[model samples]
Target: MRSLHPLVVTPETAEVVELPAGGAFTLLADANHTGGALGANRLRVGPGRDGAKPHYHGLSTELFYVVDGAMEFLLGDRVETVAAGGLVVVPPRLPHAFGAVSGTGADLLAVLTPGVERFGYFRRLARVQHGLEPFDGLRSEQDRYDVHFVDAERWSSLRGGR
Candidate 1:
């Protein structure tokens, strides 16, 4: 078994996780931890005062375990109000978005299978070094990824009419 001290993992060295609509995220593996095919992370998201335009992933599925505060989840057309002890599963491109709707921000333990490549997608969008060309404005800057919003109920099968 591979073993690494948790102290080995530091914010400056760990990979940075960012999403256009989602919040910031950080890796949780120890510097020496190993033997797993997937990566784990402790994600911290703010109010998300401005909701993400509502998009879905086609290749990767994500899971969220709420650690603190309350969140307003948009899973398809149905909105789920989740609290600190909530758990949410989102299938590939199932049209999901969430943010803290009340009180303090949210802390969650997020797991991504295969790897953190999906996190990379959002990282590329938020990085200032990338020239900020890939991002489409959510509530500002009219130029953004063009997407047709659909009701939450139809999120699972809602990729049509693009």
Candidate 2:
């Protein structure tokens, strides 16, 4: 268990990773920092860009708050567009995905409860997007990262099979 205390990450000390898909991820806190209580990061999505593919966490609840522009999200079997200042929460085992709206960009903050050390997962995402590693390499790491990929026909259709 982690001690009950405060955790602060200054901008100059935070880790930022650029993605080939455009934009970047500013990591705030990982499981280790929070004693597995929470994980947080800010995502800056480029215009017409996808933030994450369809996936689910078996043991964590993920929350996303749109800070700017608009975002498209696939929750369970529905697809919806949320604007800035909107918040979406997904409980464990619910498949979801998100991205910036076409022709527009998005900025959002994401948090996971009972945090899993996800900074490494985000780092691997950048590597995969940059072609430094194959996507298949991640298949074996789903459990370690607490992210399990799933096929979402609705999401595929919405992204036009991108």
Q: Give the alpha carbon lDDT tens digit for every residue of 13-109 in model 2.
A: 9999997656899999999998889899999998878899999999999999999999999999999899999999999999999999999989999
Q: For residues 23-84, what per-residue lDDT tens digits would candidate 1 score against the true structure? A: 56676652124433345677676653322336665544667888987766777767787889
lDDT for model 2 comes to 0.92
> What is the alpha-carbon lDDT for the whole of candidate 1?
0.55
Segments of candidate 2 deviating more than 4 angstroms: none
| Candidate number with greatest TM-score | 2
Per-candidate TM-score against the hidden true structure: 0.58, 0.97
* Model 2 residue pairs with clashes: none
List of clashing residue pairs for candidate 1: 4-32, 57-93, 76-152, 77-151, 77-152, 77-153, 136-144
Question: Global lDDT of each model?
Answer: 0.55, 0.92
RMSD of 1: 8.0
